[model samples]
Target: MSQTPIRRLAAREPEFLSTLDALLAFEAEADGRIDAAVTEILQAVRTTGDAAVVEYTRRFDGLDVQSMVALELPRSELLLALDSLRPEQREALTIAADRVRVYHERQKGESWEFTEADGTRLGQKVTPLDRVGLYVPGGRASYPSSVLMNAIPAKVAGVGELIMVVPTPRGEKNPLVLAAAAITGVDRVFTIGGAQAVAALAYGTQTIPQVDKIVGPGNAYVAEAKRRVFGTVGIDMVAGPSEVLIISDGSGHADWVAMDLFAQAEHDELAQSILLCTDAGFIDAVHDAIDRLLPTMPRRDTIARSLANRGALIHVDSLEQACALANRIAPEHLELALEDAEDWIAHIRHAGAIFVGHWAVEALGDYCAGPNHVLPTMRSARFSSPLGTYDFQKRTSIVHISQAGAQHLGKVASILAHGEGLQAHARSAEMRLKV
Candidate 1:
């Protein structure tokens, strides 16, 4: 038989952990040239503002435009795009948007306060950001789903303004993308992309308002620009490639398992997809299914390369071991295609999203599952969480100490302040004390 593209590993092997580590390693070192370019573009935007933005947009997007006005798309354009969509396409988008909105609504935080015995009120005030920027990848790639996922949460959180930036390479506009903007209630639309678009959003140009935070995905240049401008403006995250790890117990069809892996693989050559199975025969079956099904994929070459590079079919002794190993990997998307999937969720310590049971495919979570598909990648699930309404809001501590409360707290604060050797702090607290 011909060799399968993915590598096989036995968990019982002495070198298993080391092999797994090697497979997961990804380091896209920053190129000096790209860094220099991003830095130059950011500075130009910072200093020159609108003029720099126009020049960069002209050079990069191949758009024959002179001023910011040419680059800005009015609300009417977005509405026209939405109205132009075919019935089926429009229906699908509306359904998906509705689902996403409903899900994020549950994540919205509320302000709360409580009174202490001394009448001091301690609380938190949750407020949405005043403005947010959404950067949708344009030109060669455009994802209308990106708009729904990023915008819905911010809108649900009540962000005052939402600005969208998408590049129209060679003056070609994506109607679907504009349609998404129209439906999502984006306040403004700018047809600019790459580092220049990020810069304009980070530091407001003549027309583009400075957003409090920026969210969405883009190319390497966009990623670098977001990283550079993080402190100046909040950013969602510099995400890594897509990933999915499926654990099976031989109950599900091998072909279904194989297709799930391909879904992640087709995302890019660096995307990772792995299958952990207790039955050796099932692992081999999945491998065969992969070999059989790969050729039919439109992105077959990309999938093959991804599988060859990072994909794996791991043979585990038991479901327990598989669960433990999954925790160690901290995958972005995890599928528990085992019996009583919900019962096993407790064993899972980390994953950006979990798909339960054989019917719960990871692809569903990507599109209409209602959860934000913008998840943390590269083992960051161990520390980070999926993007949600919480990410769009900020909390401020609310403390109101009454005279009675101050009298009781002043002594404590004065003592701690003196111990820290700050006389000013001690005096400040003492002055609040009663004579």
Candidate 2:
């Protein structure tokens, strides 16, 4: 794993612009593949129901699931299995869940009504989703943190029910996942995954009931499936490859920066880990650190491909320029490793989540930290926000008017409706006034 550190002049040079184009091209091609796969999975699940899910699980996940009916794990068995976990692991899960719950509890909204001087009352009513589906990636990587992150928010929002789905590639569910589900009080657990699980969640099968919304992360196929089922049911976002952008000065530690970059890069070959720095010497030191650390890491092959293909070390004239480049990328994770990171935060307009200071690593946010780990990618930070209690809840505006208040406000509404050529609307308001 070799590193390339280049010192180039300021300005949006053609070569630098080409680098951006290359990254965009990579993302587009990846998205296209996901779209195709998701369309097929959605169609199959929509038509065949349980049979389709079972078939896809066998084909894609390499597990011969007997039937979709077998997808739902019995709640009793799930709880027993969780109880079998080590005390330390159970304690850690409980701590993480408590922290996540506490943070999200602070985010809860109330339904309140306010009365106006004219006897008109207006307010907003908050309601939790009837049911929500959470997808946790299975196989070799079992994410207990993901369970706490997704479930705690929905639970805090007072969701009526929560159903969790996870792929059991080896025809056996991970004890850790079940334990996490139990710890977080997940309502139901399913032993299925891939695009088929997404389809089942979107369009209910004989076994898995349709949910009001689907949340959590998955691979390309899962992401595509979410994209396909979006209209039929609500989805959080069409997540893309993981990415992290670090803005560091000469003061940042090279080893920590290298390890942080590798943390994201190891997620997938398409994942990007970039560094924007004002000091060229620090860039070289980090490059050396990456080379030293890559050989010892278990996922070196994945990390290497991600770095060689998509990763970059951008040299900028000043910290302001580095921030400008970061905003343009709109990376999923942004780290400000400068001396005074707090002062530079105002300049950051785009980023799924911003980590300030050297001690605030992105890994903390991924696990025990309060904020959600499920964030928008592919420059989606420009418009979207991280998943939170708000995602699993809905709000409806309330309005009530007394006879006198209606009489006073109706004339203005009638005039506006008539001006817009909506005669029915004008008549309705006029009739209400008369009443």
Candidate 3:
């Protein structure tokens, strides 16, 4: 395929601005399908249970799933297979898992109670959920990193039980995924995936038990299924397509920035890869590198569509303008390719994960990096935090009012309740005052 010529223009070029708007519009339109699909998957999972899950797996995965019982993997075999992994691979996984565990252990919270002015004890109790279900996507691509990312945090949070569901095509499990699960100390493994796996997790089958929260990454259908099953069981977040925004001032090597963009774009056609640069020369150079490298990649078609549609070389007037644009997009991954990145970090108000400096690539954060790769995607960075130990745990506010404390608080409560015209609430407080 002939490489598309790299377009070079001034920072304020009208052509680049129009192209940016067109790409943004396309991404906005793509979200429509996600909403509709999630609704269908959720309703199906809610009412049909195992039957719907089985049928959907067969339809979507092209696997003739006879029963949900096949979802369970024998614990012994999983461990044995893990023990057989190449020593180097096992060592790397161990190292990564340890780093992840250490970082998350620091994020763990403690329960504390304190006596208030009126001798009323007020506190917060931190406790892990009884059970959590993790969904691992399987097909041609299996992410052992994802297994480590999701399972280790839950384990560190002190969750009692950790069950995982990975959709293996035709019930054939990947040893690496199993090894990661085994090494991470996952309680159980289920060979199921797609919307069906999510359904099984949200509403338990005869074999798969329901869980308190479902966490991990998956395809569009899986994301939608999570959105639907939300109220039935907690979900980490409704993730969108992968994205990365790099702010470079032409100081970094063009090849590095190009590869970083490709890493995210290779995820899917909907993935967004953007470069915000003040230097027109750097923009052209990076574009040149991308064109030259594109054909060599295995997922060239996916990368091409992603870049042509959703990705762009955004020419910002200055670094400040680039940072402002980034805050608006709230990209899943933000790469600061500038000379002095730390100086700009304080100005960055939104981003799921930030990779500062040329040496720190997004790929590092995806694998061996201790930070969780399961991040808030699209615009969710504006509010939600990256998946952490807290996602697997819940907090309960504790309040204990003594007789004297109640008497003091009751008068204020009654007054407020009466102002709101809630007579029962007012009387309830009045009754407490009388006692």
Candidate 4:
């Protein structure tokens, strides 16, 4: 038989923790050229507006367009694209968009207020972002799901306008993405991408309006542009590679577990898939399944490379040990493939999304499971959360001081201000105490 496609680790080994940490390390040093180019592009877009955006579109995307008007897709074009989809594709897009909209509708928060005994009133005003820009990687890479995921939530949150910018390299547009925009209520569509697209959205051009936030994924250049323009506009998290960690308890079929691992591995060479099981015999069965099935996969080469580089089939002492290690990894997708999967969910503290039971696969969550597939990666699940309606909304604290309320709160503010050596603040609060 050929060599196994994955690495192996034991919970009892002396160097297990260190070895695992080594495998988890994914920090690639920033490229100086890419950063420099992004800086220049941002500056150019900021200074020259529509002219720079048009020039970059022609140079990078190879689209021969004289004006920005040619780049913008009117509402009628979007409608025509939607009409052009096959019946099956249209039905599927409609269902996915509806499910996403229904899910995010539950996440919409309401403005709330409270009154104290002293007649003081205070509250919070929950307001949706005025406008948002979505960036989708175009040209042969069609991600209609991204349009559904990002745009549905923004629409559900009552965002005023949603602009979509997709790069159609050499004038090749993905009709599915445009159809998705049609279904998700995108107000505008621009055939522009990369750092320049981000720059145009962050700082408005003549035709492209500035947005309150930017969402969706793109290549390295686009990621860097979003990173630099963060202070000027809000952005979804800069995500890393997709990931999945499956913990088995010898109950599920070995082939099922193997395919789940392969599902994540197939995303890209950098995507990670690891299986943690307690039974030694079950581990052997999974290994045999991997050997038998690896050859049949269309993306066999990518799967093999990813498994060799980062994937693992670990043997742990107990289910408890698996849970602890999973918490340490903080994976983007965590699958509990066991008989009592629900029982162990409480033990998991950190994960971008949890797939409970054997049937609730991660792939379902990617498409129709109704949760946002845009999750934090690179162990960032420990600190961040999935994108949702809350991401497109902002909260402002409301404070209205009454005469009796000021009399009570002013002294406390005065005391704190004086202690901090800010006499102006102290006097400002002190002046209200006369009431």
Candidate 5:
């Protein structure tokens, strides 16, 4: 097999930043047709309710059903799916669920307050969303892992209800996905997806209950739909393609590093995978490893296209330089595949998740490694974070003013309110003051 030559850049090159920027750039352009279609679907679901959902399901998924009840999978069906799984499958799923639940439990926020000497109590009350919608991809793209990553956090956060929507193309349902819903305590499972499902979740249908927030990955149509309904309902994020950036020293095995890059590249043709090494000789060895191992992968075509388009093998002067470039990339998944991986962690200012040392593969974190896999991509990690218990929860500020406290605080508030040209606010504060 003739291998595609991955792009190589040097840290010393004058155009290095420009070259990297071009590769990292992935802007989500709204397709006019998709947007129009989504708008129609959203409006239809809002106005017509279940009838529109049934029609879209028939039109898109080839599922001819008379009633929306046909689309709703019962809790017994979820239990049946769980029972049907092989012992090994059930065990693995259970273990992963346990780990994810345990990890997210620690992130559950508690209501806290501190009373002042003047009897003024100020604090925050942490509360979970009443209901949340989870979109899990179905058909040929079945991801049980995604179910665990999204649902477990919500359950841990004490969300009142966790409703899931998965498209069952041709009326075929993946058992593993159903089992995951059962394991994660999803309140309802609807075999509807795309823009319609999002709409149903946003605007309550007779059958599908409205959700406080929607979280999970979906196709371009689903993503655009989520974007349009942002203020109407909260969405996790309209994520871009997956990314993995590895900063490796020459000490690690070349084969391991090459496989790590391949694991990420195999996700999709646009998924970016880059490696930064201080040793040029090690980069050559990784190149050879990629060529030798490329034939063995099932998704070699995808890996090849991704590498040819976005992948890079960079030569850096030192590990410090590699860390600097990593922060600039702000990749979704970062691997410090080096001897002293811990030493450089403090230097990294951005990344969705950091996989330390050679043995700590990013794939583990995606599944049973006890962290959420729904991470920010396309440099959004510079400011955002991986989906967690916090996403499913919210906080409300609490304020109780005592006579003594308000008298002292009202004067300060009046000054600020008056400076902002709000006479009403200033007068309101002044009325509470003794003076």
Candidate 6:
């Protein structure tokens, strides 16, 4: 087996910041080929609608279905998939779905307003989207957890329609994914994927209803399609590769930490798994543990490539320095595997999600930890956020002014509009004002 050598860094080194910056940078923009292909697909769907969708499905997924109705999976089919799952599989899906649903239910926003003394009311009205589309990766990347994370939130947010699109490459489907959709109340499921699915959702077709927003993860083509169709429809985000940054105090077992790193690396060859610690001796111990354990993993080749390329083991002067570096990276998943993990929680200014304590493995959060695992990646945590019920809902500002309130407010508007040199705007406000 090939050995995975983790890059070593020291906070005291003169070029530490420059090296760290290079490692943290991840290019998120799609290439021209993907962008052009996505553009063509979007235009095709926009022009031809259902015919373009069918042709794309046939071309990409190797499915020769003639009509869109043949591509859709009925609600009964979703239920049947749920029932067909093994006992353990069904149990796990049920538990995960329930937890995700419960967690998002608390995120539901309400319409709120406050009345003022001048008979004016000011507030924000929160409303669920009319329809949302979920893009689940099919084939080798089938993820039942994604179905739960994306659909359950939309349902909890009171979205009227939850449409799902998963490609059945060569007419193959994963029953667990369908079961998850059934458990989470997905209103519709289509056996379609890639850029065409995104285009269909954004532009709508003769059969597939146009959605207000499109959420969930997909491949490069699907991501590019989302990027192109964003203005026409809302998208969750253009997610990048998986990542995990672990800060250990050397209080826990090295094997546990090694496994956590492996778990992150196994996602793909580009996935990052970095470890930061104050103790040099503990870093060596964890290195040995990784060497001893790498051969045992089924995805060792991928993990090895990931660690060799993107992974690192940093020696910080103190835990304080580790926290500072962590904030700079703004990783997607930050695991503080220390005895006093909660003590330094407030110090972390940016991270998509924090897994505190030795036992709080990032893998647990990926599945049934109750928090949505769909998070900002590629340092996007600096400004973005995790997927939640709020992503499926939108807010509108509400203002109701009485005659007395308008009399005073109109004066302010009139002055501002006239100063900006707009006669129509100034007159509109002046009409509401009385002497």
**How close is every model to the real structure, measured as TM-score?**
0.98, 0.92, 0.91, 0.98, 0.98, 0.97
TM-score of 5: 0.98
Question: What would the per-residue lDDT of candidate 4 be over residues 295-414, giving only the tens digit for each residue?
Answer: 999998898888999999899999999999999999999999989999999999989999999899999899888999999899998999999999999999999889999998999999
Alpha carbon lDDT at 318, candidate 3: 93
Whole-model lDDT, candidate 3?
Answer: 0.84
The sequence of per-residue lDDT tens digits that candidate 3 reaches over residues 1-435 is: 326533333447657556555554433345777777667766786687877777777876677668877557888978887888999988888888888888889899889999988789999999999999999988778999999999999999999999998887865677889999998999998777877788778888777789999999987777777877889999988777888989999999998998888998899878888889998788878888898888899998888888776777877899998998889878889999989999999989999999999999999888888999989877788998889998888999998998899898899999999999999998998898857
The alpha-carbon lDDT assigned to residue 335 of candidate 4 equals: 97
Residue-level lDDT of model 5, residues 1-435, one tens digit each, is 325579988989999889989989988775889989998999999999999999999999999898899999999999999999999999999999999999999999999999999999999999999999999999999999999999999998999999999999998899999999999999999999999999999998998888989999999999989998899899999999899999988899998998999999998988999999999999989999999999999999999999998999999998888999999999999999989888989999999999999899998998899999999999999899999999988999999889999999999999999999999999999998885
| Native RMSD of candidate 1 (Å) | 1.0
Cα displacement (angstroms), candidate 5, residue 188, comes to: 0.5
Which tens-of-lDDT digit does each residue in 137-208 have in candidate 1? 997698999999999999999999999999999988888899999989999899999999999999998788
For model 5, the superposed segments whose C-alpha errors exceed 4 Å read none
Alpha-carbon lDDT of model 6:
0.92
RMSD of each candidate?
1.0, 2.6, 3.0, 1.2, 1.2, 1.6
Winner by TM-score between candidate 5 and candidate 3: 5
lDDT values, one for every candidate: 0.93, 0.85, 0.84, 0.93, 0.93, 0.92
lDDT string for model 2 (1-435, tens) is 345332223334658866664664444455666777788888888898999888888886787668766667888877887788899877877777888888889888889999998889999999999999999999887888889989999999999989999998867578878888988889988888988888898899888889989999887677777877888889988888889999998788999999999999999888889888888888878888988889999999999888877887777778888888888888899999989999999999999999999999999999877888888888889999988999988999999988888998889999999999999999989998767
* Candidate 1, superposed: residue stretches over 4 Å from native: none
Error of 1 at 432 (Å): 1.2
